[model samples]
Structures are given as C-alpha cells and as structure tokens.
Target chain A: MSFLELRGITRDWDGQGGVRDISLSLQRGDFLSILGPSGCGKSTLLRLIAGLEQPQHGTVVIDGRDVTALPPAQRNLSMVFQSYALFPHLNVAENVMFGLKVRRVAARERDRRLSDALKMTGLDGLERRKPAELSGGQRQRVALARAAVAEKPLCLMDEPLSNLDAKLRHSVRRDIRALARNLGLTVVYVTHDQGEAMSLSDTVALMNKGQVEQVGPPSTLYNQPATIFAAQFIGEPPMALVEGPLLGLREGLTVGLRPELIQLSPPEQAHLTARVLDCEFLGSETLVSLDHPAGQGLAVVLPGHASQVPGDSVGVILPEQDRRIFDTHSGRIEKASQQNPAALNRQNTAPRDGQTAPEATEPSFDLNRTTS
Target chain B: MAGPRAIQGPAMTDPLKLERRRRAIHGWLLLSPALAMLTVFALYPSVATFWTSLWSRGTRRNPSEFIGLENYRALLEDPTFWKVVWNNLLYAGVTIPASIAIALIMALWANSRIPARSFIRTAYFTPTVLPMIAAGNLWLFFYTPSFGILNKIGALFGAPSVNWLGQPDTALWAICIVTIWKEAGFFMVFYLAALQTIPPDLKEAAEIEGASRWTYLRRIVLPLLMPTTLFIFVNAMINSVKLIDHLFILTKGGPSDSSKLILYYIWENAFAYFDRPAAAAMTIFVLIVLGLLAAFQFLVLERRTHYQ
Candidate 1:
C-alpha cells in the first residue's frame, strides 16, 4: 500500500476551485515532484497533505489511516516553505528543536535529534546563528534541519530551492534529494522547475490547471507526455508546438515534437523544410529556433558547433513515430506516437496514457520563472 | 543660448562668486520671518524675564527694583513650592508608566485578530482626540460626591457615598485616572505604528515552529518592537510632564492643594499674585528640571540602544 493517499480531495472557495478531486498516493521511499504552473494547485495539494488546509470534500490517508480531519499539529508531517520560513528570533539549534518541544519529547532526545539533524544538513557548526545572520543557502539548510529534526515519516517541501541562486540551487537540490533518499523518507516535493523535478523526483506528477496531467517516471513523461499541457510544461525551451493537419487522422491537429528529437539536416524526401529563425549557443547544446512558415515555429537542439545562421534554410527530421498529436479543439492528447499520418488520414487519436486523462487543465510551472 | 554661453563662460565658471551671490539673497529669504518672530516672541521676552528674575515684584510701569537672588531664596524656602515640585514628580512617575502599559496593551489588542477590533481601537483612541478640558468635565460627573454615577454604584455595593474631588487623599488619584484615560489611547497610536513595522514573516515563522501566541510575542515580536517602544516612551514622558490642561477642570489644586502641579503654581505666582519676578524665577527652575529630565532620558535611552 502507498504510504500517503489523498482521496477525492476537492478544495474550493468563493466560486473558485483549488485542487479538484486530487486523488494520488505515494510510496514509502518515493520522491514525487508535483510540477505545475503558478495556479495549478500544486502548493494547495501539498498544503492539504500537510494538513495545513482542510479539503471541502475528501479524505487524506497517511500510512493506511484517514487523517483528513486532523489539524497540522496532529498530522505529524514536516513541511519546508519556499521562503524557508526560519524563525528569525531562534538560533539554529532552537529552531531545529521546535517541533520536538511542541510534541513534548524528552529534552535529551530533543537535543540528540537537533544535533543529528543539524549534522545531516551540514548546519552543525552554525547552530548558534540566527536566520538573518546566515546566507540564503544556510537559511534554507537551517529550515531543512528544523524539518528533519521533526522526525516525521512524510516530508513535504514547497519550492524550497526557489530562493537560491542558480549555482546554489543546483548543488543544494542534489544534497536535498540525496538526504531524502538516504533517510528513506517519503517526500512530496513541489517545484515548477522541470529540471529540478526531472533530476530529483522518482515519479513526476505533471499538473495543469488543478489536476494531474500525467504521473509517471521523468523519462516517461518526457518521452510520452499524457497531455499536450504536460508536453508544453515539462521540458527545457518547452516542446515546439506546430499546428498542422494530421496525415493519419485526416483532421486539423496540433503537432508536438521534442527539441532533442528534431535533427538539423539538409532537405530529404521525408524531412520538414524550415528556415532557422534564431540560434542560442550554450556550451554543450545549440538551440536553433526553426521557422516553418507553412507550419508553426519549432526549436531544434543540435551540437554546440552546428554553425547555423538565422537565414539558413534547414530540413528538420521529425520522426513520424516520435511525433505527438493533440486535438486542436480540446487541447487533450490525441496521440502519443512516432508516426502521425498526414491530414488525409484518421480524424483523431484516442486519449491513452494508461491512467485517467486530466479532468480540466491542471496547470503547474516553476513559480520563480513566472514571478521573476 | 549660444550668445549667453559665450558671454558668461568665464563668469559662470566662478563657483565661489556664484555661491556668494546665491547665499546673499537666499539667506535673507530664509531667516527674515523666523528672526522677526524670535525677536518679538522669544528673544525679547527671555531677556525681559532674565532681568525681572533679578528684581522685586512691582508694577510694570515703575518696573521692579533689583533684589538679586532674593526671589530664588524665597522659592527655596517656600514649603508650597517644594510640595508642588514633589507633586509634579509623583504625577509624572505614576502617569508615565501607567499610560505606557495601557498603551502597550491597547496596541497589542488592536493589532491582533480580535472580534470588533476596529471598534475597540476607535473607542479607546476617541478619548485622545477629545479636548482635555472637555474630558475633565466629563469625568466630573463621576467625581461629584452624591449624585455621581460612581457614588451611586458604590452605594449599590453597600459603600457610603464619599467625597472624591474635595478630599486631599483621593483627589490626586482621581486626577491621575482621568489623565490616563485621556492619554493611554494617544500613546497607543505610536505603539500601533511600531507594531505594524515588525515584519509579518517573523510571526508566521514562529507560528510554524509551533510557538504559541505568547511565545511568538515574547521572543520575536517584542524584541523587534524595542526601538519603537523606546521612541514612544520618550514622547510619553514629555507629554506627561507638559500636559496639565485637564487638571484645571478636574482638581484645580483643590482642598489642601495636594493635587497642585508646578505649572499651576507658576500660574498662581505669575498672574493671580502678580509676582512676576518670582514667577520668572520659578519658570527658570522649571526649565532646569525639564533639561535634566531630557538629559536623563537620553542617557538611559543611549545605554538601552547599546545593549540591544
């Protein structure tokens, strides 16, 4: 059985809905990243699981028992906020001991756990320092240490690394993932950063609007996005969306292709002819923005030294079997296939991802990206 | 523009000459009105008061003759002057702390998420805006011996209707209560401003750490509001010393004159007894005492700042 389960969880207020019937379960040692855009209700879902929020209609089950009506204090779950939410007045040691103190744990055990948590988070030497005296990375570590010392089985972090600089974010992201893994902790981590979710999560629940678009391993979601929203939301530079007639479906459909799968080569019989609109050269990969005047704009990632110019016309080899198609009207996944026939074929591909299709549009993305 | 620039290149470049010209015109513009007001209201009267303090109390037309330090010596000997000074000190000592405590409580309650908080804040602060004389008059309804509501309520409790304002024992207390009622709310506004400046994030963090409201207030909120508290303390102290406007209506230094403050005594000597030299001497003494109070407050506050 899953360690944590949310059943029929519907939270809404004042004619507006938050997470609509969010039913998901987590395994014991699994790190599930809930990826979504800003208002996709990922944080709300986390809050519901943390018992900080009560669902208007649903049950939250933890370790086989219903904890739906439990208050945050009784839930025994630990949460780390994006702001870190460190107690500014308390030094590192006191902050780490807060939960144990509240729970009335033995003083000696409290001290032991606080020291252990601090050592685990690399914050042992800085136990005497207040939150304001520490750098952003150190403050986050203190928050992590505080949560760790709570010694809860379930750990929920809401965009914890969103505040750190790029270099620090990457390094700390790995440390946190490793720490959670080593503890064999059931972690429900929320982030809009696809990179963070991809690198850290055992299973990524791609959400849009207020429902999960797809829940699978990172590679599965990347290779076979259950919905067009998931395909657009969970990748670097995003998947190139092109509006075209489906050859097999014999209808107007929106075509999607991953930038990694699009190859930069001269025109062949099977290739799509497009002109290079722009090119961004990172150290290892070059993102070439290809303009298909007949189709939609596409981005193709090639080798760093591809030597492509803006005006140069190039042929993109979008493998037929690798291409994804969605209904233009519904924005739902019509087909996840390598071969999408030309506009003269079938009308639409059925929505098939082995799980339920997203109810409405569950939106999620990195908050820092939008807020920045 | 070209022609003017060509003519004034070397001329405009001389900053010293330009500065002198600007200062000559601007100096008069800035100082003229202030200098005029000071000469008429402050400077001339101060000189006259200094001269008068060295003389006897006499007619303004004849002017008092020199009696240097005699008025000062008389002030030193007068038992009533010493009593008034003591009363002033006692009034300040009692009122300052009481008003500050009440203000702090009011500010905390007003800042919290209590029911009818807006109404409670307005009701508490309403007395502050009322004219002190009017407030004093309103309190008279309760201070009256027999017909007052306080006595009527006391009678219900099986206590006799006792004279309140007419007695030396209770008159100071009566006056102090009225003063606190009027001043507590005014001080609370300062505290409210201070409380608002303590960041909200700190409170939220404390709450997440499982700190109850009390713990959060004691450890985080109170420490952060120290600077604000100090600021309000100094202002409240100054107000307590200077504010005796309500006394004239409420107590008027009644019965054995136990409620008499220094300012009222100064009023009695200056206007009622027509002793201008004595009044001037008393005024100088009052200024000295106020200066010392300000100095002591600053010294205490400076040390507090260093420790914090």
Candidate 2:
C-alpha cells in the first residue's frame, strides 16, 4: 500500500477556485512538489493533505489508515507555512521545541531533538533570539527547525522559501533537500517557482486551473509533457508550440519544439524562415525571440550572444527527433501508438522512444525536402 | 557683553559645530510647546497639591497656617480613610483582571468566523460607546433590589428578592459589576485589534503540530497578546482607581461606605466636607502608589512582554 494516499479529493469553495478531484499517492520518503502558478490551488491542495482544510469529498489515508476526518494533530503531520509562522514571542529554542512539548515528550528527549534540528538547519548560537530578532533567512530556518524537531513521518511545506532573496532561496533549498533525505521524511512541497520544484522534487505534480496536468518524475514532466499546458508551463523559455501546418504537417495539431534544439541555418536551407524579434542577454547565453508564422512566443537560446536585430530573417532548424505533436482541440499530446478515438483527427507524432513517448502529429516529414 | 563662549562665534569656521548649534536650537524650539503645556497643566498642579497638603485648611476667621504632616496624620488616624483604602484595593484587585479576561474572551469570540460577526462586534462595543453615567443608570435598573433584572431572574428559581446594592456585602460587588461591564467593552476593542494582527498562519502551524485549540491559545495566543494585555492592564488599573463616575449613579458608596473608592472619598473630602488639605494628602498617596505600579509594569513586566 502507498504510504500516503489521497483519493478523489474535491474542494471547490465557490465552484471556481479550489482543487478538483485530485488523487495522488506517495511512497515513503518521496520529495513530491505540487507546482503551479499563483492562484492555481497548489497551496490549497497542500492544506487539504495536512488536514488544515477539509475536502468536500475525499478519503485521506496515511500509512494505510483513513485520516479523512482527522484533525491536523491526530493526522501526525508537520507543516512549514508560507509565512514561516514562527511564534513571534517565543525564542528560537522554544519555537523549535513547541511541538515536542505539546505532545508531552520528555524534556531530555525534546532537548535532544531541538539541538539536532537547530544544528541541522544551521541555526546554532542563535537559540535565544526571537523570530522578530532574526533576519528573513534565519526566520525561515527557524520554521524549518520547528518542522524538523517534530520528527513526524510526513512534512508539508507551502512556499517556505518564497520570502527569501534569490541567493538565500538557493542555499535554503539545498539545506531542505539534504535535511529531508537525512531524516527520511516524506515531504510534499508546494511552489510556483519551476526552478525550485524541478531541481528539488523527486516527483512533480504540475497543476493548472485547479487540476493536476501531469504527475511524474521531473525529467518526464520536462521531456514528455502530457498536456499542452504542461508542455508550455515547464522549462526555461518554455517549449514552443508551433502550428503544425507551418512545419508541413497536418492542420489542427500543434508542434512543440524545445528552444535549445532549434539550430540557426541559412534561410534557403532552413526548415522554416522567421524574422528575429529581439535578443535578451542572459550572461552566459542569449535568448533570441523569433517572429514565426508557425508559433507564438518562439525563442531560441544561443550560446554566448546572438546579436540579431528586429526584422532580420533568421533560419531555424527543427529536429525530427525532438518534435512533439499536441492536438489543438483537446490540447493533449498525440503519441504514435494507442491513439484514443476521442481525438477529432487522429495522427501520430512519431514517438522517438518509449521512455520519452512524444512525436510529430504528421506521419511523413522528409528531412531531405525540408533541409534543401 | 562678549563672554568666553562668545569668542568662538566669529572666529570659528567649522561647519559641523554650526550645524550642531542649529540642531540644538531646533530641538529646544520643538520641545518648548509641550514643556510649557505640561508645566502649566500637569507639573504645577502636582507640585501645588503636594505643597498645599502640608498646610491647614483656612476658615473665615483664622488665617491658613503651614502645618506639616498634620493632614497626613489625621488621614492615617481616620477609620473611614482606612476603610476606603481597603475598599479601593479590593475594587482594583477584582475589576482589573476580570475586565481584561472578559474583554479578551469577547474579542476572540467576536473575531471568529461566526455569522453576523460585525453585528456581534458592534453589540459588544455598544457599552463602550455609552457614557459611564448612562451605563451606570442602565445597570442600576438591573441591580435594583425589588423589580430589577437580577430579582426577576431569581424569581424564576423561587429565590427571595435580596437587596443587591442596598446591602453592605453585595453593594461593593454590585458596583464592581457595573465598572467591569462599562470597561470590558472598551478594552475589547483594543484586544480585537491585537487579535487581528495575529496572522492566521500561526494558528494553522500550531494545529499541524497536534496542539488542541486550548493549548494553542495558551501557548501562542496569550504570549502574542501580552503587549496589548499590558497596555490594557495599565488602563484597567487606572480606570479602577479613578473611574468613580458610576458610583454616583449606582450605589454612591452606600450602606456605610461599603462601595467607596479612594477617588470618591477624595472628592467627598474636598467638595462635600470642604477639607482641601486632607483631600490633597490623599491624592498624593494615590499618585505615589499608581506611579509605583506603572513603573513596575513598564520596567519589570515590560521586559517579559514581546512587542511586534
């Protein structure tokens, strides 16, 4: 049995804004991130799992026991809130030991765990300082220490690093990942930042419009997005969904090409000719936005700098191996095999590999014809 | 007119010293308004009251004479002064904590996700908006021995109509109820503001830790509310001592001074019996005690409080 199971969870406060029919399971010690844009119900889903918010319909089972009606405390979980939620008046030591003391853990045992958590979170020599006295990063560490000291099997974190600066966020992200692994804690982290979620989570549940678009390993989410939303949402500069007919493919299908895969070629020898819109200097590399009839928000990432000016025609090479076909009607990826008849027009995006499982919407794309 | 300090004015070219002098002048100019007002209204009255307490009360025939410690000695010997002190101590001891606790409870209830929340908050604050004398009259109808609300409720249980305000034992308590009723609603407003400042995330954090509602309130809510509590506490202490307005409408220190407080007794000494020196002495004693209490709250209790 799964260590944690949420079956058919539906909690829509206004029939518009909350999570709808979310069902997921986690193995022991899996770092799963619920990732989505702001107002996408990612935090709401985490609250439901923590038992802070009751779902209108769901059965929350943890460790094979039903905890659907249980209170947060009885469910035996710990949560790091988005605001840190450190007790403002309590000193750091007291704040970390609060859960232990509440559960009536022995003073000696509580002290042991408190010291371990503080040391682990790198909050030594700051035990007596209150939350108000600490800096933003330190306050976040105090919150982490508080959750860690509880020693519960499951921990829920709701954007715990959103308040910190970019530098602190990266360091704290590393600390959190290490701490979770060392303590053998099953964590459900919620965040809108794709970088944090993609880097930290063993599994990513990509959500949009209060529904999970796809749930898989991070690589699967990036390399083989199941829906058009997932394909558009993941990766830096995101996957460009080109209109299929522009790529000499059938109509009513969108072609998703990873930006890095497109190579600059001479206009006559290119797959499709496009005008350059602008170039953004990104230190090591530059992102070149393209005005193509095939796609919207099409941009190619180039090494060093691409000093392409606006209105200049740039040739882009679309690789056959990297192309993904998504239907325009349902916005679902059309793989090579097991073609669902629900698709209005059935076509195969030649699946490159079974592991990746995404391809072009057209059957035949002669590489020789496009290249010449 | 040139002095030793005047030698530097034309000779000095240092811009820093000139700027420092300008700031000093500005500081004094800013302070003068408050200083002048305090001297005329507060400082002068306190010093004059202390000085006058040492003199004898003058009659039409006999000129007033400086009689140090005579008024104080009379106050110390008077049994009514001792009784009034004891009554005032009990009044403050009972009213202060009770008013604060009730106010906090009311604030929490009003702050919750109850339906008609605004209506409840407005209702709770209604008593605070009423004048003390008006509230005192309203409670007078409730405490009226024969046909009052208390007797009317007691009648349902077949209990005899016992005089609440007319009796010595119950009169002080009845008057305490009036003060608490009038004061708690006002204090609740402060508590309500403090409660709203407490983030909802803290409660959720505590809940996730397996803490029951009561435990969360005790450990988290109470400590967070300490600053507001301290402010309200000092207010409650002062109100219990000085808020004798209700005494006039309610009991008026009835049944041989059972409900009399120190301020009421001081007013009686100065205005009713025309003994200014004695009243002045009593006022000095009350001020010393209040000042010491306020100092303790600020210096000691304040050290323990966490202000955000």
Candidate 3:
C-alpha cells in the first residue's frame, strides 16, 4: 500500500475551479509536485490532503488509516503556506517550537528539536528576532524551520518560495530539496512555475482545469505528453501543432513538433519552405519565429545564436522520427498508420532502406502559393 | 569667490528659513481656535477646580473662607467616601474582565460561520446603540422585587423573590451586570475588527500544529489580540468611572449608598449637598487615578503587547 493515498477527492467552489476527482498515491519520501497555472486547483488539492478543506467525495488514507473525517490537527502533517504564515507575535525560536509546544512535548526535547531545526534552516542566531524583523528569505527559512521542528512524516508546501527573488528562490529550492531528502519526509509541493516542479519533484502531477492531465516524471511529461493540452502546456515555447496537408497528412489529422526538432535547411533539401519573422536572442539559444506555409507563426529553437533577420526566406525541415501525430477530433495521439493511411501504404511499395521516394520530391501543391 | 561664498551661505538658507517660519506660523494659525477652546473649557476649569477645593462652602449667612487642606481631611475621614471608593473598585474589578470576556465571546460567535450569524451579530450589538439611560430604565423593570422578569423566573423555580435593587448586597451586583451588558457589545465591535484582522492561515496553522481549540484561543488568538485588549481596557476603565447613568434610573445610589460610585458621590456632594470644595477634591482624586491607569497602560502593558 502507498504511504499516503487520496482516492477520488472532489471539491467545487461557486465560480472558482476546484479539484475534481483527483486520485494520487505516494510512497514514503516521495517528492510530488502539483503543478498548474493559478486557480487551477493545485492549492485546493493540497488543502484536501492537509485536511484544511473537506472533500465532498473521497477518502484520505495516511499510513493505512482513514483520516477523511479527522481535523487538521489529527492528520499529523505540517504545511508551509505560501505567505510563510509565521506568527508575527512570536520570535523565530518560539515559532519553530510552536508545534512541539502544542503537542505537549517535554521542554528538553522541544529545545533540542527547535535548535536542530533552526540550525538546519540556517536560522540559528536569528532565533530571537520576530518575523517582521526578518527579510522575506529569512521568514521563509523560519517557516521551513517550524515545519522541520514538527518532525511529521509528511509536509505540504504551497509555493513557499514564490515570495522570494529569483536568486533567493533558486537557493531556497535547493535547500528544501536537501531538507526533504535528509529527513526522509514525503512532500507534496504546489507551484505554478514548471521549472521548480521539474527540478525539485520526483513526480510532477500537471493539473489543468481541476483535473490531472498527466502525472509522471518531469522528463516523461515533457517528452511524451498524454494529451494535446499537456503537450502545449509543458514546454517553454510549447509544441507547434500543424494540420491540413502539413507533413503530407489529410484533414482532421494534426502533427506536433517541438521547437528544437525543426531545423533550418536548404530549400532543395527541406520538407517545407518558410520565412523568418523574428529572432529572440535568449542568452544560450535563439528562438527563431518563422512564417511557415503550414502555420503563420511556427517557432524553432536554434543552438547558440541565430543570425536570421525578419523576412529572411528559409527552408524548414521536420524529421520523420520527431513528428508526433494526433487526431484533431479528440486531441489525442494517433498511430502513424492511422493518421496517414496513404503515406503508410505508399511506404510499402517504396524502398525498404527508409529512403524518400522520388515522387514525393516535387512540391505538388504549393503551401505558400495557396496562402499569399 | 570669498565674497560671494560669504553672501551665498546665508542667502541659500534665507528663503528656506523664511519658508519654514511661514509654515510654522500657518500651522499655529490653523490651530489657534482649538487651542483657545481647550484653554477656556478644559485647562482653565481644571486649574480653577483645584483652586476652589481649598475653600470651604459658604452659605448666605457666612462668606466663603479658605480652608486649605480641611476639605481633603474631611473627605478622607468620611466613611461614605471610603465605601464609595470600595464600591467603585469592585465595580471596575468585576466589569472590566467580565465585559472583555463577554465581548471576546461575542466577537468569536459573530465571526464564525454559524447559522443566523448576521441576525445574532445585530442582536448582540443592539444594546450598544441604545442610550445608557434607556438601558438602565429597561433593566429597572427586570430588577423589580415581585413582578420583575428575574424574580418571576425565580418564582418559577420555587425560589423566593428577592429585592435586587432595594438591598445593599444585591444592588451593586445588579449594577455591575447592567454595566457588563451595556459595555460588552460596544467593545465587541473592536474585538470583531481585531479578530478579522488575524489571518485565517494562523488558525489553520495552529490546527495542523495539533493545538486544541482552547490552546489556539489562549496562545495564538489572545496574544495577537493583546493590543486591542489594551485599548479596550483603557476605555473600559474610563467608562467604569464615568458610567453612572444607570445608578440614577435604578436605585439612585440608595439602600444606604451601596451602589454609589465615586463620580455619583462627587455629583451628590456638589449638587445635592451644595459642597463644591468636597466635589472638587473628589474630581482631582478621579483625575489622579485615571492618570495613573493611563501611565500604567502605556509604560507596562504597551511594551508587552505586540502592535502589528
């Protein structure tokens, strides 16, 4: 059995989207991230597991015990809120020791755990300072220390580092990962930033419109998205989708191509001809926006910098193996044979060495000719 | 260059100095009306009262004479004065905490998501808008010996009807209950605002920390409400002395001066007995007590309470 399990959790608000029939199971020490845009019910899912909100139809089992009807205090889980939620009245040490004090732990044990937590979160000497006196990063560390001192088997963090600057968020993200690993705690972190989820979580549950679109390792979600939304939502520039004779396919059949998969090639040696519209120089690589006959604005990520200027004519090559075909009706992936039956049937009569047929070389129907 | 430097240093500051002076004069000009009113009505009367306390009351047969400390000595020796002081102490000691506790309970109830919350909140705050004299007269019907609601309920329980306002033992207690009922709802508004200001996340945090409801209230909610409590405490203290409107309606400090507060006694000495000197002496005493309380709150309690 999984250490923690949420079976068919569902909650709905009047106008706001809430989690709908979300079921997830996690083993001990698994770092799971619920990633989605704002108001996509990621926080609601965490609150359901934390027992802060009651699910209309589901059971939450922690350690093989049903805790659905229990209050948050009985759930034996700690949460680091997005606002840090540190008590303004209490100093750092007091805030860290709050959970222990609530549990009526012995003074000596509380002190030992408080000191250890403060030291672990790098807030040792700042124990005497109040939360208002601390910087945003320091307040975040105090919140972490409070949760760490609780020493619960599970921890929930709701965008805990979103309040910090980019530099501080990077450092705190590393610290959170390290702390979760060192403590052997199962963590369910919620964030909208995909990079944080991809880098920090062992498993990413990408949610869309109150439901889990796909849940897998970050690499799997990026590479083999289960749905069109997943494919479009995961990547930075997102996958470019083309339909209607693009990739030599019939209508109602679409093909998804990652920006990095398409290459700039000579017109005689390319699949389709296009003109460069814009080039965005992003430090390491340039994202070149091209105006293709298949779609008006298709993008390609080129390694290093692209010297292409606007309105420059170029040829675009989409390799056969890199093409992901989907059915436009259901927005689901389809086999190559199912997507383009004619192409598959023609391949049988063509050479077995995977060479392009001579008949396919001619631009039979000009893509740009029909458009402009 | 030297000549220009000598000329420019004062010249640079000249307009700025003139501007500051103009602003200060403008500020004082705007403030003169309020200052004049305060001097005439408050400061001058206070000094004149102190001056009046040194003279003995004069009748039509004799001229008023300076008695120096005799009025104060007489005040100290009066057993009624001592009783009034003790009664006021009991009134404050009982009303302050009882009203605060009730106000907090009202605030919590009003803030919760209980059914009929708006109606309940309106009912709780209804007493605050009523005039104190009206409330006093209303409670007077409830304290009547035989037919009052309280005694009628007592009779329903097979208990004998007791005179609530006519007896010395129960009179002060009755007044205290009235004061608590009158003040709790007024103070509830403050507590409600303070409670609303406390983030809901803190309650959730406490719950996840495994704190019981009582522990959450005592530790998190109460500590965070200390500043509000301190503010209400000062107001309640002042009201304890000044709130004698009820005594006039119910019992009128009767039954051998049982429910007589310090302010009521001062009013009686000044108006009923025509003893201005004794009244001035008592007013000065009240001022000293209030001043001490204010100092205690600012110096001791304010430091302990967290503002934000």
User: Candidate 1, residues A1-372: lDDT per residue as tens digits?
Assistant: 999898898987764748887788889889999999888899989988877778999899999888888666566678888888766656788777876776689998998888788888888689888788899999999888877887778889999999999999998998898789777789999999999999999999988778777899999999877666777787887777655442343244566789988776545432555667888888798888876533444788888666788777676666666778766556666744533444323222211222322311222212222211
Q: Give the DockQ-based CAPRI class for model 2.
A: medium
| Model 1 TM | 0.80
Tens-digit lDDT string for candidate 3 (B117-148): 88888898889899888898899999998999
Error of 2 at A365 (Å): 22
Top candidate (lDDT): 2
Candidate that beats the other on TM-score, 2 or 3, i.e. the better one:
2
DockQ of 1: 0.23
Q: List, residue by residue over B216-300, the lDDT tens digit for candidate 2.
A: 9999999989999999999888888896788898888878999998999999999999999999999999999999999999999
I-RMSD for candidate 1: 3.9
- The DockQ values of the predictions, listed in order, are 0.23, 0.74, 0.66
Better of 1 and 3 by DockQ: 3
lDDT of 2 at A360: 37
**lDDT (CA) for every model shown?**
0.76, 0.86, 0.85
B79 Cα displacement, candidate 2 (Å): 2.0
Give the poorly placed runs of model 3, Cα more than 4 Å off: A13-16, A266-278, A290-297, A305-308, A311-314, A339-372, B1-13, B26-37, B58-67
CAPRI tier for the interface of model 3: medium
Best by the DockQ measure:
2
Candidates, ranked, TM-score: 2, 3, 1
Q: Model 2, stretches more than 4 Å misplaced?
A: A337-372, B1-17, B155-158
When sorted by lDDT, best at the front, the candidate numbers are 2, 3, 1
